[model samples]
Target: MEHHIYIIPISTEKLEMTEDNHSMTNEFILIGFTDHPDMKTLLFVVFFGIYLVTMVGNLGLVALIYMERRLQTPMYIFLGNLALMDSCCSSAITPKMLQNFFSEDRRISLYECMAQFYFLCLAETTDCFLLAAMAYDRYVAICRPLQYHTLMSKTLCIQMTTGAYIAGHLHSIVQVGLLLRLTFCRSHQINHFFCDVLPLYRLSCVDPYINELMILILSGFVQIFSVTVVLISYFYILFTIFTMKSKEGRGKGLSTCASHFLSVSIFYGSLLFMYIRPNSFNEDDKDIPVAIFYTLVIPLLNPFIYSLRNKEVINVIKKL
Candidate 1:
């Protein structure tokens, strides 16, 4: 027997009703992977495995960093925060997505969707800032090795991490607050796997000009600022490495930056592709694969990238 998923649209008369009545009944049907019913089981198994790896790897990395006193440095601190963010980020989407694979109704309440979007925004934005912070730490360690300890003090590390979380919350609140103001009527069928900002914004019956502007300005600032910091840090690091007399110094510097650079490339590449455009311009069908990479795959890959590249994490794990 074949199972078919259906999304029943709200009637035009109902859409014309008052905001109060609409709010009471507002729900979104997520059109996630329904087009490929044949792959439901396969997708579920694949995503389930990815989700497991993401949870174990990220949470393990966090625990490892916290318990190992020798690994307690500015770099590892930022890495622990990254692992925490990745775990939270994957958790926000993967569980629901895996559930939807077997369930007939893929319906999510409006407020629930908003909550998911808020968390997603928080995690992703926090990650951007945290990566920038990591780059700065690397720069100080390599470029100013003599003064690294004094420059990247324990207090400063905590403050920077705290600042990243605060910035993330502020960005999420503004975006989600603006989202609440928009009226979502007509068709409540969200043409995506999850309740992303762009998909939700597309459902708005009212003009989402303010929301779009806010997304563009805020998201653009975070992305550009983070990338700029990382790039500039690497630029100086490269210069410093070239001027070094020893080949060992150059090799060590490149090895440290390579993993970070690879992770940054994957992250910012997907991020830029997804958000650096108007909502209307985004092709919903095309976005799923890209979204899966950042939201699901990246989390799974981060721990492997950091652990495989850094010997300290490996030694700590072996000791444990």
Candidate 2:
């Protein structure tokens, strides 16, 4: 327990103590993972397993991309970066969250909480932009075969990736910077699992009308613009897939884009659920699962979808 702070407890013992004394609620209590009396250990084990799998899968993807010379193509170049982002994002949130599963004190300082949310949002946004860029690569490859090399040249690939990092950081900073402007005199308890902007704002005593508008506008532009571009590229790719003269050519094209399609679905689907709608549209049962899906499940699934599903990648991994 944190010094001078009475934390919300996980057990009946703590619950009883709280009931007897009523000396809690000074710090944030995360009502996540599970609330069952007997299921605590089981929940911990399950999440610890998922965390291990996520780490190994993302780390393995990064390692393979780095070690394999033949796998250093434009597509795999973006894949490697995405893998790194997934690993970093998961590490930033999940390990601490897993610890919170057992620890009584989940109280985070306003600054520390905002920092956590900032990096998590930054990495997530970076991955989104990177996926969009990779989709554009596939669009060029399938939709313009002859120009694929020139369109997605080594120099162009680096520029796209660098642009993703910059755009993601810029997009993330608006919210984080705005969050820094608020003074937290009212309460310190965050509602959701981590220190997400939405949950934090709900607890703020000050009117976050400006901050809310900024979040919506900035989030809308980056998410909607990126997703729209990717969808448009895939739309053309799909049209070309149906019209391809060679069955092999069509199959190859679909194979190349399939992993990305799955990843985008997993990411954008979860994100839209979490962020696209206003809080009026969100309920606890609905939002909590979506939050966990985006923050936890997607990272574990991204590398597998990208690496094992691609023939060239699988061959590279098998050889390694």
Error of 2 at 3 (Å): 44
lDDT string for model 1 (123-189, tens) is 9999999999999999999999999999999899999999999999999999989989988766888
TM-score of each: 0.92, 0.87
Q: State the C-alpha lDDT per candidate.
A: 0.90, 0.80
Candidate 2, residue 123: Cα displacement in angstroms equals 1.0
In model 1, pairs of residues that clash are none
* Candidate with best TM-score: 1
Model 2 Cα lDDT, one tens digit per residue, 1-320: 66786786599887798774443333445555545647768877887888899989988888888898888889889999998888888877777777777787766655667677878888888988899998899899888989988888999999999998998788778888897776554545555677777776666667888888887788778889889989999999999998989999888878778889989988887887777765723345565677778878888999888877878888887786
- lDDT value, residue 180 of candidate 2: 74
